[model samples]
Target: MAKEKSVYVCSNCGQESPKWIGKCPGCGEWNTYVEEIIRKESGPKKVSTGMESVKTRPITLNEIEAADEPRIDMYDEELNRVLGGGLVQGSLVLIGGEPGIGKSTLVLQTVLRIPEKRILYVSGEESARQLKLRADRLGSASGECLIVCETSLEQIYVHIKNTRPDLVIIDSIQTISTEILESSPGSVAQVRECSASILRFAKESHTPVILIGHINKEGSIAGPKVLEHIVDAVLQFEGDQHYMYRILRSIKNRFGSTAELGIYEMRQDGLRQVNNPSELLLSQDHEGMSGVAIASAIEALGLF
Candidate 1:
């Protein structure tokens, strides 16, 4: 038997309350508290009699072996730099952007170009044919990449276990729903639970998971605040949809530098990596422009 449990949680700040309130006391947000269902302990409790097992081990830090592990170099230098020289193993990255901002295109291009690893791209928003058409236009579909059109998390997990891909990309996390949550898909509760399950799977399997998420009208991730904290990195893709330029900015990174940014130019064929970003940034023939000076920063990779 399970006991009935009820609580109120703020949608904006993720604050919890024992009783319903019109305004959140912690964040001072109005009309953000929503009643949530939580399972309470109902079974009989048993007290531990004594310690059944004990083990003591001491190890010195100097005795541990250390080695410099190499990272997989990607075709795009800017992305590689933003990911701290490369994508680390067992990392979970969240990419959020507005609709039609080329988030899907960027991941698809990466999967096609990464020849060394086997990638599994699971699409919940788009069908296989639709992805194929886009892949054809971008010239990104390769033999190493596998595409699956599924929305259920259970089916996705099954495919992941059988294929054992080197990398996994989930197109838009809002569409994914778990069975444990009674709320509908895309709800605050559903999104949080689904993301947690994915995070656990990624860490336990030592596989990198790339999650695509949609942003609200306020330019933030659509789900609750906990979604951002569960992942290892949060990358915000920002740029005008009409413009050819796209910027991949890192908001949070556990294995890499957060200050790094990647810039790319969208094209009909595919995304072109911009080597010298300043060239595109500055207007042509601005040699004698007023209040403008050409500043140079010497990058360690090379002079830019």
Candidate 2:
């Protein structure tokens, strides 16, 4: 029989507590403690993550072949530029945005446009038929793109191993759950465990995993703050739904600088990438436009 342990965790800082309290001792947040159940094993029980063990063996630097890492062209100029010249293999990317913010549209349009890579899109929020309908409206039902409606994290890995897709995209990470964890889905423990599992697999198989995440009312990524630390890159999609343009900004990137940004225009036929965003932002009709000025940054040399 497995033993159970109960602990209160602060949602803000992920600080563990033995008893319930009005304020969190770690982050000083009030009434943020939530009880979480953890199953403890006797005699050092073996842990099974369902799809197979994610454990990896350490390798020496000399063992690896030194060469420039290969990248996959996404076929979109704006996306390529923001991703630091295409997506890198074995990298985990997190795309977070508000509800109805075109996060799904951007990803579906991208995978459908790229026919070179075998893509597996796992949707926990929508059915496969719904995804197909959306694809039809996007004007491309490429045979290269496959959709599976599943919420079980373990089953997702099973399909991945069988299909052996070169690229994998999860519609929303919040909906996926793992049986290895005792807490409910979307909980702090579940989110961290699931993300860690996916990260390990991506590194071991040399495949890229793109996760769609939800944002809170505070305009920050939902769930534990540690989720952002586990991913290789965190890309934020922001813009008002009423606006015609959307911006994709890189908040954190391990392989490249975070100053890169991508712009897209939402249209009836899916998203259209803005090749030169500067031209669009700069007004062409300068006549009768008061207070419109163009300024350029100048660097000056100074003695150290």
Candidate 3:
């Protein structure tokens, strides 16, 4: 049997050290070191026999075929416009917002609107009954949507493999933990590992994933910097809790433009998409109002 190896790793920069240090030399962060156990293996792990592996062939640039892939159509036109048309397969999206900013409500509404696709919504914070109550209140009773209340990444993967859903939504990434790491949930290590695993699954299965993440007191995603880099897109839901209007902004997009924005209005039923945004911004009630001017803004994809 091989002895287990242990090392202290900096939580900020992932630098390994023989012993705990008060300050991380790599990132210059103080008191960010944490000890982790490293298991020793005798040989390389065996590959699974379920899937057959194929070799790749190198081809010339001219021989490669290029075509514009169509995006998935959604019932919400405003959301489709903001996503640069619609959602793309095998894309990983990260959505973050403040508490009670209507992040969950926005995603739940989207899921309800898309009835053609099979969606798997995994909640780590809420129970199935709680989600059903919210869905009922929002009038979102869909037969195609599956709800699973789980916090373990391993169990989540198992459900994904069995269900084979077209879309997957993680309510909040901070609450999910992985078995590979010994740290608790919401830790830097656990967050990175869990997100990477989900990203891999989405890519390999050619399924789109929407990950809802919690922001820290600093209003940033509560994870390492690499978590943002691993995903294909990052969206932020911003608005005051007291305000009736909410904004969904794309910060990073690999398949589309990031300048697009989606606006929604909070109501007793649910989030209502603002189709004619200009009308809402400039109304007849605001006529003759000083210092207010109406300007025409053109969108790239002819949405406006």
**TM-scores for all candidates?**
0.83, 0.86, 0.83
What is the C-alpha local distance difference test score of candidate 1?
0.84
lDDT of 1 at 199: 91
> Residue 46 lDDT in model 3?
90
Worst 10 residues of 3 by lDDT: 295-304
Error of 3 at 284 (Å): 5.7
lDDT of 1 at 93: 91
**Which candidate number would show the highest lDDT if scored against the true structure?**
2
Off by over 4 Å in 3: 1-37, 41-54, 283-304
C-alpha lDDT score of every prediction, in listed order? 0.84, 0.88, 0.84
Q: State which candidate has the highest TM-score.
A: 2
Pitting candidate 1 against candidate 2, the one with the higher TM-score is 2
Q: How far is candidate 1 from the true structure (C-alpha RMSD, Å)?
A: 6.5
TM-score of model number 3: 0.83
How many clashes does each candidate structure show, in the order listed?
Answer: 0, 0, 0
Clashing residue pairs in candidate 3 (N, C-alpha, C atoms within 3 angstroms): none
- A best-first ranking of the candidates according to their lDDT comes to 2, 1, 3
Per-residue lDDT of candidate 3, residues 142-205 (tens digit)? 8899999999999998998899898999989999998767678887778778888889888888
What lDDT does model 3 reach? 0.84
Off by over 4 Å in 1: 1-7, 35-70, 286-304
